[model samples]
Target: MSSQYRTGSRGSAKAKVIALVGAGALLLTGCTAEAKRGWLPNVERDTTNHTGAIQDLWVHSWIAVIIIGVMTWGLMLWCVVAYRRRKTDTGYPRQLSYNLPLEIFYTAIPLVLVLVFFSFNNTVEKSINAPVDSEVVVDVRAKQWSWDFNYNYEGQKKYFAGEQAHLNTDGSAGVEETLPTLYLPAGKSVTLELNSRDVIHSFWVPAFLQKLDMIPGKTNYIYLTPQVEGTYAGKCAELCGEYHSEMLFNVEVVNDAEFKAQLAKMEDGHIGEEYDRQPNKVNSVVVEHGHEEGGK
Candidate 1:
């Protein structure tokens, strides 16, 4: 009786520790806030997409996760309690080998669960990968440390961002500045064609939850929607060059009127050209020495 009581007490303590550990693990993976200015927003953090289908699928998958977790813990505890070693422990555990039926049952159950999970996952993948007939498109190219966004608002009617343009400036410290801000009208299905100039680079937007690889020769595609109205920071995901951490772009999702106005302003002003010209003008002062030449 004493041995049985002691075993029960030990089992209780073990179960409490296991529960605490599990809870701690879950808490570690729980939500914590960050600066939200990109493809991922501060509000919707779990499995977000432009269409929100991926998010829905994730919710279903987590249900399975919870169910499986409970079953696993239950089974583990059952085995532990049933086969625990007492004070006068025997030489070895019971000689009961694995049962074929039980093994098959376990295999089949998990297989079926996996298939169910995959069905939802596959559905989402296919839906997302489906051909977009009227999807808005953008081309993107990335090089060492700059991002150039070119929107084809002319004859082709295909808008693209990320063209690998070599930035040249008079100064040697930093290269010329390319397109800094990306403008997109909200509620439009924008597609981006991604490429790399020098090395591999990744264009990632936290709010839009979209990322595309900019390969040397190959162009990749990233599809997303601007769900909300804001300015989001685009970060480089791949370790391309020296300024990996400093490599960042901007995505601005605004209304159609706002986008058109911004584009019109850019066209009329030629901001980039003006920016380049201003620097040369500022540094073009020729210093002439007349009497100071011999005096010094």
Candidate 2:
């Protein structure tokens, strides 16, 4: 009878523990409702055509991370407290060696997690990389410490070019210098063909949440549709040479009329002759001493 009573007590303890764990899990699940409502903080703000979809994936992934973390820590704490070496414990605990089911479970869960993440990420990546029927095609050239943006408009057999950002003459990097502006029409898709004159560089605009590497011999393409209308700063994300930090540029998202106006101004500027020259088959312009010459 005493043995039966001890077994019942053990069963009761297990039931109590399971009930507590379930309650805690339910509480956590309730908290995750906030995540469903989009309460995650670390996610970047959605400003472009791609940022919203990216944020959705980011939030969901973080939600999974939080749940896994809570459950893992909860189990660890329960084990530490429930199996601690108490003074009343006389001999060693059970001599059990291994738990095959637990091991298989741990292994299987990570595999399943990786598969799910890969699947979702693959879908999003494909969506983002899909071809764009662009209304504007811009040629981007990255050199040692600067960037040049060129736009080829319809019916204009020439390409309009914008210069690189120059550092302030005051010797104080504290003051912001005038950076070349990349003008884009709002709600229009634009395709950029990127190339590098020297080393590798990354074109990154934080608001766009998209970046592409510029290779010296290869031309890369990036498509983006800006949803918001504003001026955003851009820079080279890659660590190039000594003045890499000064490779700053600005992107101006404006109305269609304004974009055309900017293009017209670029074509009528003093360097319009240089802009009229087209690059040969390579679609890359030549640069000497930070000045862009006609394409080879």
Candidate whose lDDT is highest: 2
Candidate no. 2 TM-score? 0.72
TM-score of each: 0.65, 0.72
Per-prediction tally of clashes: 17, 0
Q: Candidate 1 residues 179-252, lDDT tens each? A: 35678877777767676645678988766555667776677776666667777777789997676765766778
Task: Identify the candidate with maximal TM-score.
Answer: 2
Per-model C-alpha RMSD: 12.0, 12.4
lDDT of 2 by residue, 22-115 (tens): 9998767646633454455322354568888878787899888899899999999999998899998888888878899999999999999899
Tell me the spans in candidate 1 whose CA falls farther than 4 Å from its real position. Answer: 1-32, 35-51, 86-91, 154-179, 267-296
lDDT of each: 0.61, 0.73
